[model samples]
Target: MSARLVLHGVCVGLLFAALAGAPTPAKAQKIYIETDLEGASGVYKFSQTREKDTPPNIEACEFLMGDIAAVVRGLRAGGAKEIIVSDGHGSQAFLPRLMEPGAKYVTGKPRPSSGLDETCDAIVMVGCHAMMGTPDGVLCHTQSSKSENRYWYNGVETGEIGQSAIVASYYGVPPILVTGDEATCRETKKFFGEHCVTVAVKRGLAREAAELYPFEETRKALFEGAKRAMAELPNCKPYQVKLPIQAKKEWYELDAKGVKGKLMTREGEILDLRDLYKF
Candidate 1:
C-alpha cells in the first residue's frame, strides 16, 4: 500500500475516536418527585387517606401510584437521567410493585430529608392537596388533618406545598411541576408562578367533595404535564422563603377524649428552612 494511503486511513480513525468522545448537545436532568395521597385521582374523602393498610387507603395509594407512573414515563421520555420519588404522604403510601421503572423510590419513616440534593435539576410534586382552611380544598389540611394544622411564614399563610418548595429552594432546586386538585393548582400558581406546570385532576367543591376526573384523562394530563415541566426547567425559578423566617403556627388542642378541641397558636422564628416542618 502507498504511504500516503496508509496515512489517510490513520487520520480517519483518529477523527472517529475524537467524535466518539465529544459531548452531546443536551444534558439529561436529575429530577426529584415529592408525592402525597389526598390529591390523587379519585381521592376526595378522608376515609381514603386517613388510615393505613385499610382497603380504602390501599385503593387510594394505587391511584397515586398510577399517577406517579404517568409522570415518570413522561420524565423518562423527556431525557431524565436520574429520578428519585419520595412518598410524601403522612402514612407512607408506596406500593413497590406499582412503582415505575427507571426511578428510585423512597418510603418509610424518619427519612433524613425530602430525598432532594444539590445534584437534582428539578422537583415535581404529585398528588398535592390545597393548604389548610381552603374552602374548596378537597380533604385539605396542612400537616395534620385531625389537628387542622396551619402555618404562616413572614406573615404569609402557607401550607404543605409551600413548605416543601421552601426546602427544595434551600438546595437551589426549582419546582418544575405540581399535580393535584383545582384548588391545589391554584395554590401552586400563587406560590411558584406560571412557569411551573400544574395539572389538576379534580375540582374541589368542599373539604370532602370534588368533581373527580376520569383516570384516563388525568393520567394523560399528568404524562403530558411532566414533559412540559421538563421543558420548563429553564423558566421555573427556585421558590424563596426569606430565612430567619418569622413563623406562626396554629392547631386544635387535643381534649381529654383524644378529640380536637380549642384552637391553639404559637409564634417563633425558624433559623433554617429544613426546620420549617419541625413545629
Candidate 2:
C-alpha cells in the first residue's frame, strides 16, 4: 500500500463585501470528494481504463472530472467554504489537472485517524461502481480487480461506499452525495439512508456495456444534488454501524493463472472485516 498523502487544503478567504457586513465568513463547510474511473459518465467498458491501446484515457479522465467539477461547483454554490477531493482510485494519480481550485486533493487511500479526521462535514463519492457479481454492476469489483473476491462488513455485503462510510462515521461524517451507475445508487441508498443524495450517470446493460445519460445532464444533476444535499445536511445522518464490527472475505485471485484469470471474476467466501476497524 502507498503511504499517507494529501495536498494542501483550499483556504476559504473572506470576501471583503460579505465580511464587512457579517460578523465573520460563515463557518467553512469542509467536504471530502472521493472518485474512481468505472461508472464515470460516458464510460462504457473497461478498456477505457484496462487497455492502453484504446482511445486516450484522457477522454475518460475528462468525463470523470466533469462530474467532480460539477459537484464542487454545487458545493460552493450551496455555501461550502472548503473542499478536499481525494484521488481515491487507481494509483491515486488521476484528477490533478481537473480538481477544483477551491478544494484540496488527497492522493492516497485514507485509513481511520489518518489525514481525514472528525472535522469533515460530509463525504462525497464520484464514479463509484457496485460490488462484485452485481448482475447490473458496471465494471464491478471491490477495491481491487484482482486480489480480493468479496468483502463483508458485519456480514453485510458492501463495496467502497460502505467501507468508507463506516470509517467516516467514526469521525461523525455522513456521506451525503454519491454519483455513479443506477445499481450503485441502489447500494448507496441501502447503506446510507435514502436521504443521502444520489445522481446516477449511467445504467448498466452488462459488465462491459452501459447506457449513459447525457453528459451535460449528469453533470448538472450532480451539481444540483450536492447543492440540495448541503442545504439539508441536517437530514444526512451519519450511518452508525456496530463496533467490534466483524468483516469477512474470501481469497481466490491468487490461485488464478495471473491476476486477470477466472479467479479475478469469480466470487470467494466471506472473511472478517472487523480487524480493519481496530484503529
Candidate 3:
C-alpha cells in the first residue's frame, strides 16, 4: 500500500482500539476549535444583507453559532475536557452567546501570536472553504481581503486550511477534525494527509450556489466526525513540514519583494520566511 494509505489505515486501527479498550484516558484533552462563518451548513453568499452590499445576515449568524454548539457537544461526548473555540472568520465575532458555556471563546481579531495554534493538544477547523483559485469554492481567499490572491508553501498552492495546519504542526498540535464544503475537505486532506476527520456539510454548485445538508443533519455529522477524530487521536500524526520554511505570494499586481523573503520560484513566490504568524 502507498504511504498515505498506510497512514490512513493506522488511524482507523487506532480508533477501533480505543473503542475496544478500557475507558478513554481520564486526563482531559485540550481541543482548540476554529470556525469561519462562510462555510456554515446553509451559507451561500457571505454577506449579511439580502441585497448586494450589506453586512452578514442575522439568521446566518445564528446558524453559525448553532453549528459551533453542535460541534462542541460532540467534542464533549468524545471526551474532550477543555475546549477553546476561536471565532476564526472575518472580524472573529460571528458566534455570540450560543457556543457551549464551558468552552472558552476567543473572539475578535487576535494578534499574530494569539492564533489558533498555541498550547493546544488538538485543533479543529470548522466552516472553512478551499484556498484561493479553487473552482467553485465559496468566498475563497488566503488571508487578506485583497492584493495577494494565491499563497504557496514549499511551492504548493494552499488555502486557509493549509496555513492553519502548518501553524498547528509548528506547536505539535494535530488537526483532529475539519468541517466545511466537500472541496475544502478534499483540499485539506491533500495538504495535511487523511489523519483528520472531515465532515462535508455542503457541496458548492457554483460560487454562489451549493447543495447543503439540512442544518440538523449537518450538526449530526459534525458531532459524529468529532467523536471519530478523538477516538483516533493516538494514530493521528502531526502534519509536519520541514523547518526553514518558504512562502510565495501570487499577487495580481505589484512586485513580490514588497512582502518578506526573496523570490525562489519562477512563479514569483517568496522564500525563507520568519515563521507564519496570524490567521
Cα lDDT, model 3, residue 188? 75
Q: Report the C-alpha lDDT of model 2 over 172-199, residue by residue, as the tens digit.
A: 8889888889999999989887799998
Whichever of 1 and 2 has more TM-score, that candidate is 1
* Candidate 3 Cα outliers beyond 4 Å, as residue runs: 1-21, 49-56, 110-118, 145-148, 253-274, 277-279
Tens digit of per-residue lDDT, candidate 3, span 209-246: 78878988999998888888888677666777665556
Candidate 2 local accuracy as lDDT?
0.75
**Which ten-residue region of model 1 has the weakest summed lDDT?**
20-29
RMSD of 2: 12.5
Cα error of candidate 3 at position 270, Å: 8.6
Encode model 1's per-residue lDDT on 1-279: one tens digit a residue.
999999999999999999999864455479999999999999999989987999999999999999999999998887788999999998899999998998999999987666798899989999999999999999998988888889999999998888999999989999999999999999999999999999999999999999999999999999999988888888898999887999999999987776978999999999987777786
Ranking by lDDT: 1, 2, 3
TM-score of each: 0.90, 0.79, 0.79
lDDT (Cα) of model 1: 0.92
Q: List candidate 1 stretches off by more than 4 Å.
A: 1-28
TM-score of 2: 0.79
* Candidate 3 clashing pairs, residues 3+ apart or interchain: 48-55, 48-56, 48-57, 248-270
